[model samples]
Target: MKKNLFVFLLFSCFLTHSQTIRKYSNEFMNIGVDAAAMGMSNAAVANTNDVNACYWNPAGLIGLEDSQAALMHASYFANIAQYDYVAFAKPIDDESAWGMSLIRFGVDDILNTTQLIDANGTIDYNRISKFSTADYGMTFSYARKLKLPGFQYGVNTKVIRRIIGNFASSWGFGFDVGFQFEKNDWHFGLMLRDITTTYNVWNINEDEFNSIKGAVAGQNQDLPQSTEITLPKAQLGLSKKFEFHNETSLLASGNLNMQFSKTNDIFATDVVSIDPALGFEYGYTDLVFLRAGVGNFQTVTQIDNSKKIGFQPNIGLGFKYRGIQVDYALTDLGNQSAALYSNIFSLKVDLSIFR
Candidate 1:
C-alpha cells in the first residue's frame, strides 16, 4: 500500500511539472488511434493487444500467438471529418515482431479567401476564404521479447507531413521507443515519443507579413519567412487485471503523458498541460467488452480560466464477433460548448494468418 501511494504521488508531481512545457499546434497530426477498440476506452495505453501494440506499446506483441492486422477510422468533431488508421503486425520467429502503421487527418470544402483593396488607398474587408488542413504519417516498428526476466522492448520511426492550403506546407520525422514488463496479470509500460528534436520545414509563399506604407522605414524590409516547428511527447502507464470468475475479467489502469516543445509552431510559444487518466474494461469470454474512463489536467492548464476542474469526462463501448470489432467513444470538454463535441467511432477486422 505504501509503495502504491508513493507511485501515485510521484506521478502527480510529474503531471504538475509537465504543465510548464505545454503547447498546441497541428495537434490533429499527432493524434494517435491505435485501435478502434481502445479508442472507445479513452485512448488507454498500458493494456493493449498485439494489433495495437505497434502504436501504444510494442512490447505487447510478445504475447501474441501469430500475425494480425487491423484498420480503424474516426470522424472528428463532425466538421473536421476523415481521420483514419491502419496497422499490421507479424512475428519474427518466436520472440520478436515487426509492424507498420499509417494515420491521416484531413478536411475539405473550406472557403478560400483573398485580400481586397478599396480605391481610397485603404484595405477593405478580407474576402471569405476556403482552405484545408491535412496531415499524415507512416510508421515502421519492431519489438522483441527479452531473454531477461520480465522485460520487452520496441521502437518506431515515423515520417510526417502537414499541408496548410496552398500557401504553406511542412514535413518532419520523429521516433518512439517503448518498454513493457509483465508478471502474472500486472503490466507496466513506458513510451517516449517524438524524442528526437523534430521540426517541420515550412515554405511560405504569401506576403502576409509585408509592412504597410506608413510602417517604420527600416522595419518594412522583407524578412525570411521560412521556419521549423517541433513536437515532443512522453508517456508512462501501469495496469493490473483482476479475474472475477471463470469467464470474466476486469482491467484497471492509469496513465500520465507529458509533452515538451520550444514552440507550438516550427518556431512559436505554446500552452502545455499534464493529462492524467483512469480507465477500466470488463470482458466476458474474450468475445465481448465494455469500457469507460475519465481524464483531466489540473485546472491551471485549462484553456478557459473561468471553468472549474473535474468537467471533462470520456466514455466508450466496444463489441467483437469472430474477427470483427466495432468501437465508439465520446469526449466532453466542459463549458467549451461552442466547440463541437469530440467523438470517435471505428471498425476493425483482425486476421490471423498463421493460426
Candidate 2:
C-alpha cells in the first residue's frame, strides 16, 4: 500500500492538464510577464525599444539606448497567485549588449488534505497540512549587430526549476534564439523559444513520500517518476511607427505565434495551433503612454454547425521621466470562476544616470 501511494504521488503532477489533450508541459512559462509587454498583448517581439526586450526578443537587447534595469510584479486571480520579474542590461560596445533576468511564478497557502484524519480516525482540521508551489527561471542573453546594417541577432540560455510543496522538484535547461530587423519606421522580429527542447527531470524525495504514505495508509498506489520535455515554438511580429508634429506618435503591432510540436491534440480544427495578437500604443515624446491589445483568439466548432470563440482584451498606461519609468496594466482572464482579471505593475530605471 505504501509503495502504491508513493507511485500515485509521483505521477500526480502530470494530471494537472487544462484540456483533454496534453501535448506540452510547463504551461506557466506561457503566462506573459512585464506590464509593458502584457499591456501590449505580448506582441512586443518587434517593438523592443525598451528594457523588456530581453524577454520579448533578445535581439532587441542591442536596441537599448543605455544601461537599464527593470522590475515587474503581478497578482493573478486576485492574489491567488503571483508573478515577478527583474532584469538588467548593459551595452558591451557599439554593436553588442548583454542582459540577465529572473522570473518567478507561484501559488501559496495550498492546503494539503492527504492527512485530514488523526490516528484515532477522528476528523481533525488541525492536522491538515499546507504547502506552496513555485516555478523559477534565470536567463542570460547576448545580442549583437549582424554584418548587414539594421539587422541584429541574439541568444538566451535559461535554467528552470519547479517545486511542489516539498514532495517533488524538477530542474531544466533550455535555449532561445531570435533576430530583429529595423529600417526607417518599419520593424520586424522572429523568435524561436526552447530551440533546444527544454527538458525537466523530476526528483521525488523518498522520505517525504514515505511520510505521506504513512498518513494515508491502505490508500497507496505504485507510481513512476520521469522527465518532461517542452517543445519549441515560433513567434513573428511586425510593427510600424507614425510620428506626429506635436511630439506625439502612434505605433501599431501584431504577432503570429505558432506551436509546431508533433501532437495529436486538435485545436481550432487542426493538430497545430496558430494564435494571433494585435496591439496599439500612443506615446507623447516618450513621456506618457497609452496602450490596448486583444489576444487569445480561439474558435471551437460544435457538431451542429455552431461555433464559440474565446477573446481576451487588455489595457495599460505608463509614464517615464529622467532615469525612471512606471507602468500599470489590467488583464482579462476570460470567465474564470476564481477571478476574472489580473493587475500588473512595472518600474524601470536607467543605471547610466549614476555612471
Candidate 3:
C-alpha cells in the first residue's frame, strides 16, 4: 500500500491485484486516432473511412460521405504527457450511421509527496502538494449497411474514466464489434476490442490511503483491490486499391493484431498472439496524400543474449480541400517520444461543408 502520490501517471498504468484478464487494458485506446491512422502504422483495420471511424473500424462508419468532425492533439515525455481527441459523425437515412468519441490521457502538476514526512520523521518541505493523473474515454457508435451487398456493421459503447488525484478512482464499461467487407476492389476488416470484458471499478482514498501507511518494512501493507480487467482483442484487416493512369493512386494495408495470452508477438503462442501490420497510401487526384507504416513486432533481448526484431515505423501527411481534412503524423506512441512537437496532428470536417 505504498502509492501515496508522485506517480507520474504510473507510467500509464498496468498495475492490478486481482480481477483477472487485463493485458494493457484501455491503453489510451490503443493510441491511434486520425493522423491518417497514425501515419498508417495502425493499418487502419481495412483502411478507415472518416471521423476516425469512432476509433477505427466502426465498420468504417459506413465510410461517411457527409456529416463529420474530428480533432486531435498529442504530446508526451518532454511535455510530461497529454493527448486528446474528439469526433462526431452522422448519416442515418441510407442504412444507418452515427458516432461520437472523446479521449484524453493526462498527467499534470504531479508532485504530492505524501505530506513529505512528519510526525517524528520531520522533513516537511512545506508538505508538497499538487496532483493529477487522468484517463477518460467515451464512445458511442453504430453503423449498418448490410443486406449482404458489400456488407458492413459496427458497434461500440465504451465509457471509462480513471483518475489518481485524490488517490484513486475508476469506472469502466466496454464493448466493440465491427466488420466490413467489400468485394472486387478488395477490403476486409474485423475488430473486437473489449468485446465484453472490460471492467474497472476502483475507488480508494482511505484518507488518501493513510499517507502511504507503513511505507514498507513489515511489508504487510494491504489495501489493494483495484479490480480492473480488460481482455478480448482482435483485429484483422486487408486492403487494396491501385490505379495509375491519370491521377495516380495506391493504397495497401494489412494487419493481424490479436491478443489472448503469450506475447513477444511475431506470432507467439500459448493461446493467441499475433501482431503484424503494414500500411501505405499514396494518392494524387483525390487531393494529395502520402503515408507509410510498419508495426510493433517486439522480441528484443540483447546485451549478448541476442534476439532482435523490434519494429514500428510510420510517416504521414495528408490534405484535402473543399471539405477540409488535414493530417500529419511522424508517429511514436509507446516508444513515447522523439521530442520536437511530439508529432501527430489531425483534423477532419465535412459537416456538409456548412450546408
Q: Rate the local accuracy (lDDT) of all candidates.
A: 0.62, 0.79, 0.80
Q: Total backbone clashes of model 1?
A: 12
The 10-residue segment of model 3 with minimum total lDDT is: 1-10
TM-score of 1: 0.75
Question: Which stretches of model 1 miss by more than 4 angstroms?
Answer: 1-22, 34-43, 115-131, 206-225, 260-273, 300-307, 333-340, 353-355
lDDT of 2 at 166: 80
Query: Mind giving the per-residue lDDT tens digits that candidate 2 earns over 302-331?
Result: 689686666668789989898798999887
The candidate scoring highest on TM-score is 2
TM per prediction: 0.75, 0.87, 0.35
- Give me the displacement of residue 140 in model 1, in angstroms: 1.3
| Global CA lDDT computed for model 3 | 0.80
True-structure lDDT of candidate 1: 0.62
| Clash counts for the predictions, in order | 12, 7, 0
